[model samples]
Target: MTDESAAPVSSGRRGRSGGGADARRAARTATTITQAGFIRRAIKPYEPFTDEQLQLIEDNAEIVLQETGIDFYEDEEAVQMWKDAGATVTQGNEPRRFRLRFPKGLVRSLIKTAPREYVQHARNPANNVTIGGNNTVFAPVYGPPFIRNLDEGRRYATIEDFRNFAKLVYMLPSLHHAGGTLCEPVDVPVPKRHLDMIYSHIKYNDKPFMSSVTSGERAADSVAMCELLFGKDFVDQNCVMTSLINANSPMVWDGVMLGALKVLARANQACVISPFIVAGAMSPVSTVGTLTQLLAEASVGIAFTQLCRPGAPVVFGTFAASMSMQSGAPTFGTPEPAFVTFGAAQLARRMGVPFRSGGGLCGSKIPDAQAAYESANTLWPTLLSGVNFCLHAAGWLEGGLASGYEKLIMDADQLTMFQKFAEGVDFSENGQAMDAIREVGPGSHYLGSAHTQANFQTAFWRSSLADNNSFEQWQDEGSKDIVVRANAKWKQMLRDYEAPALDPGIDQSLQDFIAQRKAVLPDSMS
Candidate 1:
């Protein structure tokens, strides 16, 4: 898109010309102090498990692999690997099943090279987003098979649903990344679903992108599709298109997901190995117990990536939600989840890798009192405590199993607040407001002064929620709730929405490809 507003900063060129010398110096200085402070406040230093414990877990993982097995892949190489690893490989016309072996060494290696802090590439190099630094990116919540259906794998997902959610994402200024595949429609062919989602992303927004690990083969195809649409340099120069790989924690790796990691490595795409360790489900009941399970799982995933491709981009994706035994479901927006978010951030720091967690996601069924309190209370602490990236920023209600347009807008506001908070004021001589204060006098207003007028835009956060109107005017306006205001704002943005103008021929190429794929599907399906 020819957006003058999105152009790279001239200062950035100078900074790079110095080969990031200034950045390196700043990073080193900040790291040293932060590390020292972290040590003082950390709940416990990261300690490796005893050899006996490690052996037991490994043996148990093997047992689980043999008993419960993972599904997908009919490739010969995969079949052979499964056999070599002593997994029972079953070949079939449909999806195949295979056992997985947990390699401790591979797990350790992924952890070692995983970067603690790094910038993800965007199609526009300038659009790169950093994680594990002062910057934190927020994206929409993902995975609702049906927008409102309570049943799993029963309701079919439609293209209209995808487009509606994409439109919502486009309007959210605080959502810096697009969380791919918010819902998987059963009606859409599995092979084409990712492509359909990407088409929506390209048509709707020009931000960082992500993908779901539907399968290893699909992961490879997804990366290929992105390169075909974007460019070969897309992964290196543009925002990161990260693949999400969920590990069966307490157990090191799931074979299907591990295969996807290999595919991502071959493509040189960055990925977030997010292990959703539900306390009392995949992990122990205690917070420490859960943290340890997450660490072990993350370390293994990180190690695998580096082993296959050294320096391969990866983040320690930790989403630790506690399970309510009463409901037997993962609880979102609770104190335990918030605690895990903070602890995970600290843990990722110790391991020197980026961390990912939830945001604005509450188990609340609606965007009401419960939703507001849950989102604010959980997100504020997470952002302040130094989380690098928030994966589920918007469109979540009912514990992240549903998406609501109004809720997405409210979440966007929350994200904006967090961004403002992260940008703590610089108190250097130039930043001090002493001169402006002196000029205004104690009783006089600074509202009309040159200094006030000049700096007001950058000096404070103007809320989309709080009323700055006079009390009399506010009372006359009916005092609508924040949700009502947000809904109105969302509709306005949609009316004014403009698709980014891509380089000549890029959009056409993408459209043509989609058209070709559509032709292959049944007429009714198309």
Candidate 2:
């Protein structure tokens, strides 16, 4: 478990003291923007819904919003905000249940204020990406309470495991954002875990990362740390940090999540106004009905963000999936979620904000046949579904209960195929290959031809983990399976990991800010 080669850069002390030859070299050693597996496909992914269906979904969603109204629970500030934004607000007799119906054209007008596409700036400028339109950006797994692997089985995740995952995210080129909660590092105290998690992300990866949503204070700490990493003024101007703010499904927004939502939105950071719903449980089991609720809920959350501050960035996030009625357990990678993915994304486009969904999601206990089959099903459509920001791009298993190290590598390998798929086809002179075709003339091998020699290196999508050897040759290589190979690959990645560099002063200040905030907050768990 000890990795001396790429020991995590100390959050307490990283980077050189000042500008010099040494500092410049250190900066170069840091992971620069090496492609984040996104392809701006000339040919867009195949969308499922037709004009009539799209109209039905949108019309019904607007009906839900304007008539029944969405709930804004337990927060007077939010209630007043909604009321001020032209919603008819009223409190239910029950505690924490507030309902407000929007005017017919309100949500649409609110959505129009948001940009159709906007750039999410990274600490390393070259890593910046446009989050809407044809672009699809991949991000690592978010919340998981445990870590799982063939060797480790299942256990509460530790700081060590979290750091290793961050290193893996740093090394992996497919993942665009080094997500906020790779897992809940239970080893770190709950009250202070955000400090360590945020520090690990800030120090280990130069890619654009997420902010803390555990509490308003933690969320504030994330902004402060961001301000330290990128300057306070620069961050205020650019959309740097994106946070997940989930609406408690069956129509409610919790106080704590709203706290983070407000802080991130007001500062001009982005929020994925997601509703973490199970279709059969928290929502109506029928696909059309569920889509209606999904859109309505997102409309309310998006309206809330604009209420927080007009022109703030938001993603119309969809996490609705079905449940196995037999066991009452959550299900993923099924036809229902795939249905939800395409439908929800279509709805997101209609609403005109960017969307986020389709992670490497599944409900399987281990990285077995079930896990591979389920995850692959979801991933293929994710590229085609017009998902703008793909969260949980890797390392997810057991229905988001655990972050499997081996699964992370395997899922990333899947992303390579989709990134290629997203690129569609090329028909330029070389791609058309008229001359090469004429030379070959429909017969003999192209292996030795001038075309093959010229394009061989770039012709194929190569996988580092998938085995292509014959059975006899495979047995000679220890008869390894995917999980076995993945184990070795992740360990080697950690061994090769170098903590991406930062300016020394920025590094020190980030650490200092974390320390100062930790000092003030009581060491208490929520």
Candidate 3:
């Protein structure tokens, strides 16, 4: 997230000395991407529920755990852990599915070992991000199987597309983490895709990144890769990666997610115990009803991580959305989900863990007005709710089905605005500007005042995407829309991107490890 791009600021490649226009273009593109610090909220979080109301929700969640129970599917070890922890277990109708009913205080007791906040270290120390407390880390769109651009429409993503998005995230200052699974690289063999995805994140960006949770084996591969990049000792003591482990909604934790969670917890890595809740389908339709289910579900997952390894880092993550009653399609940026996020954030703080939710979410099929409006709505709640880690912060489109090229640029531009807003109102002597008031007293303008001259360049946040020029000037400049401007911005970023430095010996070791793994593993398409 910091501007420690392996290369120095003045070392960017320049154009050949041929023409004045070419030299000017090189100079314009040569400026280094500036440093961007992760946001730490200065304003208080917007907690929607009173203490008594929160207690009611908490009590209801315990009721659900005691009465309805949660299911652990196809993981005998997980079931055994819960049974050992004093939870009542019953065999489910389906094979390998067991219902776990915990006593009121058991889950809370197990979660006591989790750290309230932890630093996820990047290769460059400057890029390290704090997760939890008042901090907010912005990561790019996750789990989009398709990539969309104006020129090509939408298509199943390839590894090339994955690398392209990684480079974009590396260059975009607003994105604080090199997100996992930027887009599903469908072209690669399904079994081996995680390797490529993990490699792409490390090679393209030095910032903190996520691990592969598609399977336990893949998660191990991610750890091994990190060991090669960062020494094994460093990997063992520090959190090099933070992965997503989601629960199956309606009170179920499947084998795949449980497996990945166990690996990460045992390795001392961080994982977000998120429930993929789509209200009306996955959980209850009512806002309060959904909050109860979310708390109950996330509690079980977070407790299970502690069961795996005490003092492991975990996040109380919720991916909540509303389903359209008529069409059954999921909706984003709705009031109901915002309410759920606010309630869930308070619950996370009460449980003494970091919260993760919201993003530039939208159900719109393209980067049009609907996309902008929905993304804006979701982003506002995300910041105000005190979300500690925001996945899908940029580049999401079409209800999380695609990663839009233009949308990422536009959303990143807005992230800068959020960073400025998070600083709250500055109250310094310079900020007060008493001298400016005196200099421009009574009807006189201050644009040319002494204080104005001193602070003119830093007075306001500027948009890199929005055009505020005169109509005549806009017409003369071709009157491009934001999307068009964003498209051009991404292209220029990729062209200017320089890969972060990697030690040759470590890089070779990683290559050898990957080659050995690929050689032994079958080329199974699945």
Candidate 4:
């Protein structure tokens, strides 16, 4: 995660007197909360692996576990815990690395401890979402160093930019979650930025958001803040936060990530065990080979979560993009990656866990033809592959080096189309409209029919930015490209955004918590 958004741009709301510092402040506090994000109901999912192949992969994964084993580096208790759970654990050739060899069925049984599905609660109860089962939840991009837009060109992200993104995520009805590390705020110190980031999520958006994974302390901060906002009793009893913990490819789970996992799991929160793979560099180049590694890595990571606290909600995530051999840069939204994602989802479903896919990933340098083409390609397959949790759902650009303002709006518009399609067609009697068909008769227009008139608004999705006018009319309206329109769209959203209503007392408590943490932790330049 690298970048952050810019300062809140000019919005439609202005103070009573006119444009000035005080007016800007008044406009910033405009309070409006829309309904929680909509979910994608069941779309018949595509199964890439047949029963025979699925069984083969499972058997192969077991052998891989028996042979290569898994390294639980820097966590001695974890190694002994694995031994206690009936797995063969031994110290690695190097320091602090312990390799675990699971019994034939031990790994699978451990994964079974995870629930089939669970709820991820938001500060606003309305934005709470279900992960797994029949729901498809969309979350925004995570982790980038740079921010890009029409006005700024390219620059480092700051806290102001970060807050602006949270506000936008709150205001935009199309996005499901506010997401984590929407972009890295380099301006903030590394050890302390997480505090600012979590505060931004709490203050700007009432939607569900992710916690930082920089360390166990950072993760604890996430939990402490939640306690202040939602109360300790509620936090302990409910899964109020979900965070991402990426596994080092080739079957290694590092210490920092494991620490965060421990904190989140013991708190009864959720974590997505994602294997960060770029085929040929991190894993074998072949899609099948890459998926095998993805599965093996996810298996052990999920098992660790169960060790932390059995029955902790967990998601099996796959990020199997490829790397360009010539430049060593990552490639996204390509066929190899798609195949890996499809196969991974099949495996996760086989294990009965919620599955995640990198949402709308693309390698395009700009939000141009390449970006749209690649993003659309990725989104369609991700939806069809039965992805339960979609991260990087919108605004991912330049191989995740930066987050784009226009790209977020464009990807969101495309998401609307996919969301509609994922809901599939209705089969009810009224939906079938046999009476309307009979009444209309042969060759008659349905446009003026009773059924059409009654269901017009709800029947079809209306695109916010699509230009559907006739050629002459569109020309008369001034021909515009997708870029120009997307730029205008995002800016207008920022302008119109109002902070969702947050209770003053709870808000103050959160502020005090952050201040106390900062005072003790002093700025570490690392």
- TM of each candidate vs. truth: 0.75, 0.95, 0.94, 0.91
- CA shift of 462, model 4, Å: 2.9
Q: What is the overall TM-score of model 2 with all chains considered together?
A: 0.95
Cα lDDT tens digits, model 2, 1-526, are 4433442332222222454454566756654436654557566756788979989988998899888888777677888887877889877867877888988988888777777778887766667778999888888888999999888699999988888898888788888778879999887778889998888887777677899997877888888887776667877888988789898998777788888898998888999989888988999998888888888888888877887888899999977568999989998888988888898898888788898888888888888899888888888778888888989879989889899999999988888877877777878899998888888887677888898899999898888788998999999999999999999999888766677556666766767778887788776655
Highest-scoring model, lDDT:
3
Query: In candidate 1, which residue ranges exceed 4 Å CA deviation?
Result: 1-106, 116-118, 148-157, 185-187, 233-239, 249-252, 436-458, 468-475, 516-526
Tens-place lDDT digits, model 4, residues 322-404: 99999999887788888888889888888999999858888987888899888888887788898888999898889888888
lDDT of 1: 0.62
Model 2 spans > 4 angstroms off: 1-22, 28-33
Candidate 3's C-alpha runs over 4 A off are 1-32
In model 1, where is the ten-residue run with the lowest total lDDT? 31-40
RMSD of each: 9.7, 2.5, 6.0, 5.6
Alpha carbon lDDT of each predicted model: 0.62, 0.82, 0.89, 0.82
Q: For model 3, how does the per-residue alpha-carbon lDDT over 1-526 read when each residue is reduced to its tens digit? A: 3223422211112211134443345445543456597998898899889999999999999999999999999999999988988999999999999999999889999999999999998876778999999999999999999999988999998888898898899888899999899999888888888888887787677789999998999999999988777777878888989889999998999999999999999999999999999999999999999999999999999999999999999999999799999999999988999999999999999999999999999999899999999999999999999999999999999999999999999999999999888889989999899999988999889889999999989899999899999999988999899999999999888777876655444555666788888888878788
lDDT of 3: 0.89
